[model samples]
Target: MACSIMVTAKQFFGDPITCITDEIPQKVMDTYCWIQSTFTLPHQLDRVAGEEVAHDGVGSYVDGQHEKKYHKYYQWVVFMLFFQAMCFYVPHYLWKIWESNRVRNLVSDLNNPILEDEKKTKQLKSLTMYLKDNFRFHKWYAARFFICEMLNFVNVVVQIWLVDRFLDYEFSNYGTEVLSFTEMDSEYRTDPMTRIFPKVTKCIFHKYGASGSIQTFDSLCILPLNIINEKIYIILWFWYMFLAVVTGFSIIYRCILCSSPQFRLQTLRMRNRIVDFHILESVFNHGDIGDWFLFLLLARNIDQLTYRQLIEQLDVSITKKTDRESFTISMDNERESKDEVGMLKIEKVDDFKKF
Candidate 1:
């Protein structure tokens, strides 16, 4: 947000660019530079100013299409920064809304379990029952947070690509080119920052003359703001790339924990070894992915003593539920077997009667 405010002020409140000339009006030439943009003659950068080149990177660009680089990102940078800030905010907003004080409400007074004996017991039991009732239904809750991590990675990658296109593909290698500064000769060591954000560039303005003919005026423009731009973007380029790598690793870690039951069990055991091992195994076997995510979250928020008690209660309830289901299935199979035997007996009796 601060970045957005700063850029908006720089772009709208005043001009960061100034073009000097006597052939055309100052106001018209400044406006032309803002709209039409300025370009650098890269080959002219090597020539001395005032002798061969009028200004650094300010000379002929005709028939040198490959050598000329246009500065088109000046006006759009503010909007781009503003959009990036918005993209980051979206995940935060969604997490807050979806979470909606769940952890707070669940933890409630348990956060400080130093309550009176009866109050502690009551609060602990209430949390246990709530978890027991909703064991396999937290898939969305867990997925929402995981998705937030993924969105962070996606946003960084997309913003990088977008900025690359915004800066005429120069941004894709901006960091790499900056790193190779040591290899270049001292006599011709033009900073990659300068190439991307040049100090001086050329813009041409056209108008009608008194003789009913078009008049052309070439303006040499100075960008005092590119100094700040170069500094900001170089830092941002490295930071965003690092963030992408870290987030990608985070996603991989989550996948490993979720997909590998042994890994999840080990993590749980490390969190609270005092809990009965068989109870943990039973709870794990009876639940889905969402249930496992919620258990991990619970382990982090509550004390080990309270968590152990809660898991014990859940194990009791889930074990009974699973047993009832298994029993019902076995009875159903038995009933089906009896029906098949009865049909076979009936068929045999009919065949004997016909004989």
Candidate 2:
């Protein structure tokens, strides 16, 4: 933002040096030059040469300064860049909120060992149902994430249009000409004055109200500010292009990760290993692949685990009922053996007494 504002400031302060004139009277020239330097006007004049030139207000100079028009627009562009950055962050914030409110509580309940078996079983069933519902919410969150990237791409393209609109057709075509693969040569790249930003241009100045006649002057003027504008836009053009490519790739990668079942399964397996190995949470916490997406994938895996546990519990209950009579008979046989051993010991004692 400061860089952008600095470019505009250079243009504003340097507008006076944009035009130069010869052959005009020193008094008239000084007055005109003062006006140009002192005030921001709707139009400006270029250098002119003639034997006798009429004196008019400085407003009768060359074309209006393009930089004046561009300053406000550039500021707005910088502001929008900040706004888009914030937009990208909003989804992450919302995901954190959802995790705190919904996910943490479920995990705490499921991990508690002191709960009755029946209660734990019920909680598992409930957690599975809850996760299925949250999966739909994850889809929505993922959509928002992709939308942010799309907006970033759109912003870059819009900024390009804004550059063209304010800077004119010559600057608008700069990207195509400069970035063209075949057009770049050593001469074109090295010559900043002529190739990057042209400084020389024809300027017209009109002098009014001297002897009720208007005097016009035309000459070549050197625009120093064009150099600054040219350099700024060139860098911006490349920056926007880089931004567009990265955002495009991000969108594509995210789509592939979400849509492919195999990828989701692979992520789930990796997540399980992470949990089992007691890995650092930071490994998954601070990456482009967001924590919320990982959480959703893990939720699906937990749902599967819940179903498996329920099935095993049902199998235990059914088998226990069928084996009840066998278990009772084994217990009775052990008791009978103990009683017989005790009765033999008592008989030995009675025989000794009779002897």
Candidate 3:
């Protein structure tokens, strides 16, 4: 009963200390405390960062008037780069995973009428013939499959290099404890503070517009600087793995989402048309009939021939729907008397947004 009350108090007021009352169950409180301690990153990170102002001190390599800059500039640059890589890129891949899941649901809900469109199939054949006469499928596949795939691979390699560089530099300044001993020795032995006494007052730069001046020349050493103790390697390993998995999942899931049953049927019809017209075999000499069929299948809006050309070449009447709000199209036979006319009512929903 006390454990429940303590948990309730913490849940209501947002303080874990409430869970520590003597009335509470010891086991429950212990578990809660352990969880809280394990999951949170160190709050000491920022405090240690402020104290280890390597560039602020007088004896530091870059702090002298002749040096013209802070020694910490390089460290800051590296830290910022790594922060961006971890914060921005990791979330980016996670967001892609979420997007893929959403798109997959959207595709599953879309509607298609290919099952009822015999006239549409006939009209598709005519459209295919016209495409054969006009466009070469081989050229498109050469660029899309060969060129784009190679570029994507190169981009992945470049991303890995940049991320590795950022990580390496960001963590280097952590192991600088030996500098503190050197600074202490230089301050006492090298200079006589008695005779040439400039003002002995220590003024600290308050970068945040506060009145407190920083002890710029203070020799500070960062404690527990080892990233291994922090389990950063495990975190980074999981982060990179998640990124790769999400990227691959996004590509597959996006394809599935955009190609709803209706979209898949449309693709199949396009492929069948390409095959019937002999465009797949003639234009793309490198690809087999099946390969060209798939290429045209996945490609959107691939009607390389006009309605007039389709009619003249294949004796079919293909008509597009007039509604701009919908992506629907239709095809019919002008001469053949059939009660069932082919009417396609395609809608460009959210699933197809990426494509």
Q: How would you order the candidates by lDDT, starting with the best?
A: 1, 2, 3
Candidate number with greatest lDDT: 1
Q: For model 2, what is the C-alpha lDDT against the true structure?
A: 0.50
- For each candidate, what is the lDDT? 0.82, 0.50, 0.34
Which pairs clash (backbone N, Cα, C closer than 3 Å) in model 2? 44-61, 44-62, 45-61, 45-62, 46-62, 56-207, 56-208
Model 2 stretches astray by more than 4 angstroms = 10-17, 22-135, 170-196, 219-221, 267-273, 276-355
| Residue 124 miss distance in model 3 (angstroms) | 2.0
**In terms of TM-score, which candidate is strongest?**
1
Question: Who is ahead in TM-score, 1 or 2?
Answer: 1
Model 2 — TM-score against the truth?
Answer: 0.46
lDDT, candidate 1, 117-212, per-residue tens = 787778878887887788778888988998887888888888889888888888888998899877888667767887789878888788889998
Predicted candidate 3: what Cα RMSD to the true structure? 21.0
List ranges where model 1 is wrong by over 4 Å: 11-14, 48-55, 60-67, 113-117, 323-355
Clash counts for all predictions: 0, 7, 3
- Candidate 3 regions exceeding 4 Å error are 1-115, 169-355
Tell me the deviation in Å of residue 334 in model 2. 41
